[model samples]
Target: MKNKSLTFRIFINTFLVGTLIYFVCAFMFFGNLYTYFEEQLFNELESESIFLEDYVLNGDLLKLQNLETKNRITLIHSNGSVYFDNTVSFEEMENHALRSEFLGAKDKGVSKVSRYSSTMTEKTLYFAKLLSNGDVLRISCNQHSVWVLVLGMSQILLLILVIAVIISGISASWISQKIVHPLNSINLDEPESSDVYEELKPFTKRIAEENFEKAQREEIRAQYTANVSHELKTPLTSISGFAEILMQGGTDPKITVDFSKSIYDEAQRMTTLVNDIIKLSKLDEKSIAMEKEALSLRSICREVMEVLSASAKTKNLSLNLEGDSGLINGVEPVIYEMIYNLVDNAIKYNKIDGSVNIKIQEIQNFAGDRNKVILSVSDTGIGIPYSERERIFERFYRIDKSRSRSLGGTGLGLSIVKHASKYHNASMLVTSEEGKGSTFTVVFEI
Candidate 1:
């Protein structure tokens, strides 16, 4: 119903209102017109009665009997006998003293009365006046009631209503168009400058905002495509060049071992990159099935630390754990992945013999209703610059691209941590300074 055009709705509403008004006016007009016509008939009868009384005073009884008129005239004696009647014989007519109009005239000098005939088709109005000679002169006429009059004019009234409906329809359509024209003319691309109703300003502004956001998303998508193509091409070229060298029979025993090892490393790096891309894609699309439950943050952190202990040992770094049991409700696999990535990044970017400290403690939440678990990985390594801290969580964004590639870093580790944190409804806070150390803390609501 809301999808209907404004013109159609307006036309229907106006037509219905017009019909209602027409009925009301018709009822009132017919009623008042009938009453006015009855009053005028009574006045005419009264004047004729007065004239007959004058003729009787002048002894012109013969003229009363021969009066040429449509109305019926009657003359009554003071003793209640009918002396003369124009429409009927005086001997056959009933006595006039008991008549309502005659009795009214005896008391008031002049009066009128109306009654419907037995057939109910005609109504008779009787007006009577008292003469100076102690006689009553009466005049009567027949008229119709308001309802009968209305029935006779019904066809003409119906025709008028039909004409009114057509006019109302055209007027309603014009009004609806005038009201909607401003809305139709608005330019969505430049909503601020468009001439529109004040009530519609918010809607137009929202459209403009959404268009800008869509454009930004498209730009980001284009940049991501180019980055993915370049990243994949680099490893493919390395593998191809090494295979060509081996095919040419360039075999120095020591160099052959080195080339084969380099080829294997490149293959492994590409595999890792592909896997990370797939994982990021699943996280981005929110397709990863999550079964939430209470999990021990301390245990997950300890398990990740044990797995990376050998890698830390190669650089002679101390991987230590602090604090106690920290419980939070989250998907176990996601929690495990988040911890593993943070710990891995800490170890990978740390200087040799540097210490990596993992802390699991509970603190009062911002709302102060319950305790929230805080898992932090702090490292004594080359810290990030303040300006680059925020961008580090973006996929494939690296502050030092050449050094990051040399270290076999895919640059998606921190991005995964960010996505996991969001999925778990946690917050990631990083504090780092150049040439010093950095701390990455994740606060999870319990």
Candidate 2:
């Protein structure tokens, strides 16, 4: 569907409203003018009737015959006979006894009435008075009806309407332009800084926020690409050098076996790195469609301990599991991976004879409602520095790069933990003191 221009809509609305108002005012003005004219005509007729009444009373009726007037004059006898008429012969005129004006004047001394012609194009006003001599005096005048008056002045009215239309069109166009100019001038690059209408502030603010997020995402992508390239290149270089040594002949069998093992170790490191990258990508894109189910956090912690028991033993670290069997709804694999990474990191970074304590428990609010299930891994190890804690969850971000690589730490473990916790609608909190211990906590809403 095609969108219509805002300016066009505004103009049409303005023009229609102005035109309607104009017509309404014009109708009211003309209607009042017609009424005023009728009233004036009646007053004149009343004055004339008063002046001629004395002449009839003095028996000087013949003198009224010479009176010059545009109005029609009539004198009627008490018995309903028309004795005198200025515009028509009295003998041919109809009797005035049955007339409303004449009958009203006989009863009330004075009266007036208006009558319209059959075509309604003409009107006649009649004023009648009762005389002292048992006779009635009547005066009348012809007038154009309100419709006829309007028709007579139609040209002037039409000219005024045309002028109003032209003025309205100009005003509408100016108003529409004034309203739209601000919107067109907005700068999208700095939408929030643009001087825009107050109503449009929220719209501009949203755009600004989206632009900021887009820039951050672009920066992160570039950094991630660089990190992936460097990480892959290191393992590939070591494997290539070791494989070349093995291919050479006439070497000691024991040395050959050692070189081949070195090549295998590098390949295994590369495989782990590739797998971690794929998992992070899937979590980021939300492509993992695993269904959620009820699972115990303590059970998952025990499984992780079993898998890393040998690694813990090698470090002379004691792995302990305590607290309640915290149960939550989540994907099993994601939950297991997150716990496994946390425990493995704890064992790797712990001091000899130091403990890696894993705890799972459900916490309740003051209202006695279960609020969240918490899984915490606390290690008595060389802890993280406060400044480096924030960056630990970033991929390929290692606090001690040389030591991390020597311990077979991929540096993506915490990043994976972060993504998995987020997938389960969980939050992570870290608290540590250098050279003492560190604790990582994941809180899941129940």
Candidate 3:
């Protein structure tokens, strides 16, 4: 039952409600009908009793005896002795002294009473009137009890029930289909644009959100695959060409050595690219099991500068670290990778003899409480354009592809930085001019 379709449930609910209402109305109609019939019978009996009282008063016994009617007429003396009866001989009938209608008519001049038979399925209504001769005239009739009346009309009532069931079934089915049609017609790919019931707008909106996210993920996955293939192919082609040249016997020793070195460099480049891809995959998938701990941004900066110092020296770039040892709670290795990537990008893009400045500091809120730590890396380099700043953190996205490749940059550095910062509930801000320089700031809540 719980697994039934929506239409089925709707139909069942509608049918049950309709059936309930029908039963309630049927019982009420029967109740009022029974009351009306009983009242009509009583009124007829009272009128007949009034009309026949004159005949008994004028001593018209022959006329009363010859009269024909379905009702029973009885004449009782003032002392409750039966004088005459239409349906039976007065001597054969029981005494009426103890009867409620007899006593009531004797005192009130006229009275009415209903009595049920021993079987309880039949009843008799009596209207009695007191006469001028101190005798009583009674008119009586038989009636079926309420349950008997219902039983007598069982076939008609059953027919009505059948008709009701048929109508209710048709109405319920039609209504359920009308209600479910809009949901069935929803286009999952563009749910938000589909015409749907107002009550279901929130439901369709959720589907739209999921669809959008799925499309984005698929797009990113496709681009990442294509980029990885192209990036890997370049190094493989270089290594293959260099190895081929080195294999030829006529090559000079110095040139052969240079070719071998070129092959090794290409291999190293491919290795670096593979490792970066792996790191990004781990970060994206949340596959890393490392726990977060208290760490200093200043300490991490010092380590990144030490690792990249040689590369900075080659470009004649000065590496400087300033400000306090900003503390934060974060995964240590992920934090290290994020800082390393930012500093590396700075040094790689800086002009010859340019300076890469690393700063770590605490920021205070309006209440003067130091609740945030900021790490900003700025460099004197060919900075990013406003239009391209947003996409800089995309996987393998490079503004200057040739310069980026020449610098042995894998192009996933900023992407990794973005993911890692997000993992630590941090936000990254990029401020750059096309040619002057760029500043990358990561803000972390402590």
- Candidate 2 Cα outliers beyond 4 Å, as residue runs: 1-4, 46-50, 63-68, 74-120, 126-138, 159-163, 244-255, 364-370
Instruction: Estimate, for each residue in 229-280, the C-alpha lDDT of model 1 and write its tens digit.
Output: 8888898899899878987885997878888888998999899888888877
TM-score per candidate, chains pooled: 0.78, 0.84, 0.82
How does residue 33 of candidate 2 score in lDDT?
Answer: 94
Candidate 2 contains a number of clashing pairs equal to 0
Kindly list the per-residue Cα lDDT of model 3 for residues 1-446, writing each as its tens digit: 68579999999999999888889999999999988988899899888877698899889977888889999999999888898998888898888988999999999998889999999899999898989899988899999988899899999999999999999999999999999998899999999889998899999999999998999999989988999999999999989998887777789989988988899899999999999988888888776566989898898899889999999999999999999898899999899999999999999889999999999888777486548999999999999989999898988999889989898987899999999999988999999987789999999987
Q: Where in model 1 is the C-alpha error above 4 Å?
A: 1-7, 28-32, 35-39, 42-142, 172-198, 363-371
CA error at residue 259 for candidate 1, angstroms: 1.7
Ranking by lDDT: 2, 3, 1
Q: List the residue pairs that clash in candidate 3.
A: none
- Residues forming the 10-long window of minimal summed lDDT in candidate 1: 363-372
What is the overall TM-score of model 1 with all chains considered together? 0.78
Task: Estimate, for each residue in 1-446, the C-alpha lDDT of model 2 and write its tens digit.
Answer: 14489888888889999899999999999889988988898899888877798899888867888889899999999878899998888999888899998998899998889999999999999998999888999999999998888899999999999999999999999999999999999999899888999999999999999999999999999999999999999999988997877777777999888988888888999999999998889889886587999999998898899999999998888899999899899989889889999998999999998999998878876487558998999999999999999899999999999999998878999999999999998999999989999999999998
RMSD of 2: 3.8
Cα lDDT listed for each candidate = 0.86, 0.91, 0.91
What is the overall TM-score of model 3 with all chains considered together? Answer: 0.82
Backbone N/Cα/C clashes per model: 0, 0, 0
